[model samples]
Target: MVFKRMLQALGVGGPSVDAVLTSPDCRPGGTLEGAVQILGGDHPVDVEYLAIGLLTRVEVESGDSEYHTDQEFHRQRLTGSFRLEPGARHDVPFTFPVPWQTPITEVYGQHLHGMTMGLSTELEVARAVDKSDLDPVAVHPLPAQERILDALLRLGFRFGRADVERGRVYGVEQELPFYQEIEFYPPPPFARGINQLELTFLPTPRRLQVVLELDKRGGLFTEGHDAFGSFDVDYATVDQVDWVAKLDGWLRQAAQRRGLLF
Candidate 1:
């Protein structure tokens, strides 16, 4: 019994946790259903509570530098308290709401390079080491988002990599502190003046706030600088809009002519 307690303290023989998702794939603003399966340790243990949260790797900027860290934004409490009897197994069901502005990790069934997310199960154990596990999760894009992305692809822009940048997009009603940047290489037509295109989305219940950052390429006599633009689209009318022409017009008329202000 003493040995068992020692092992439990080290979490070697303590309650083990495994997070199981009903489906690994979900769209932004959707729900992910899952269960936290817990198996008793070698001895009985008191569990304070069970919680599940969504976490992702984000890059945070510091003074003249940036660093990456895991960020957890959404969590759901499973239970107030529970007892794990020796040699027993329990499953705690959960339904976690994916944030409306959750970053897209996959597009059309392909993983976005450099994007990742996890569903982490954390068990609060009393007088014992905490037990937890992290499960991979894939968040897809919404229709409006997909339409814009497809429009970019149609424009000959190639997908680069994506990452979550720390700090909010100024002037945007950003609920979450971080924003996702989907990078793309400018096609041949604009490659002379455009270095890259970075896209971000902040979706509310009624509309999707899209931010575009244009990285300009410097020529012999000019210096390179970044430009930004913010726009909104009604979720109800996303499908009705012709994304190709609309996005093209936005890039040409607004970004090139007037320039996107930071």
Candidate 2:
């Protein structure tokens, strides 16, 4: 409510808004249900509409420079025009679908070090400044996502960091303006072959599109370069896939040398 006081301070009386989420934890391709509780201030006021948005921090680059900023990825309308009478209280319920590409904010019940996601509510009051509210929201990994993460840990690839960068991965089908990258240091067996590994997941309702980036190390009579690979995995059958074996194959393929324009 500290942020809401700005609107309240401008006038003697104005309607106030508070967003309450009934179900705050969700996965990509799922819906978040919530209610906006509106309270009347000193007089009657007309409200134009109410909406909820999913927001996160993202990095943007411009002319060789990059910076981070808060961005809203998706929005859902809750209510149309309405009137708030003196001391009247109203509840507006909403069910908004989380985007299929929604970034994962938590894994195995632990918050990702640098990732954050939230639900922001906007209330436009006629003839008065609009009021706003925000609540912390968590997007958990889907079944396939969970299994991959668990497998990576089991493979001894320690988590390094994660971030959302502004731009699309070349050759990747994505609806969002950006994508999330999860970085890890290579395990003992692959450490000498690779400097590090970056993993990105482009998930749809039916399956997952995984991209792997390998930073290969330079060796005698050779130069180091990045190698890329992409593949699809079914959500229903992902559990059946031998990820450890599959990932090992990917490591070998990505480490193999390829002819270049050089």
Tell me the TM-score of each prediction against the true structure.
Answer: 0.94, 0.89
Q: After superposition, how far is residue 148 of candidate 2 from its true place, in Å?
A: 1.4
CA-lDDT, candidates in order: 0.87, 0.85
| lDDT measured at residue 135 in model 1 versus the true structure, 0 to 100 | 94
Regions of model 2 farther than 4 Å from truth? 1-12, 217-224, 258-262
TM-score of 1: 0.94
* After superposition, candidate 1 runs with Cα above 4 Å error: 1-5, 258-262
Count the clashes in each prediction. 0, 0
Per-residue lDDT of 1-262 in model 2, one digit per residue for the tens?
Answer: 7555655556457877898898789999999997889898986777889888999999899999999999999998888898878899989888889999998988889888789788998888876778888899999998898888888888889888788999999987899999998889988888877878888989987779999888777778988888898889897788788998888776765575443211
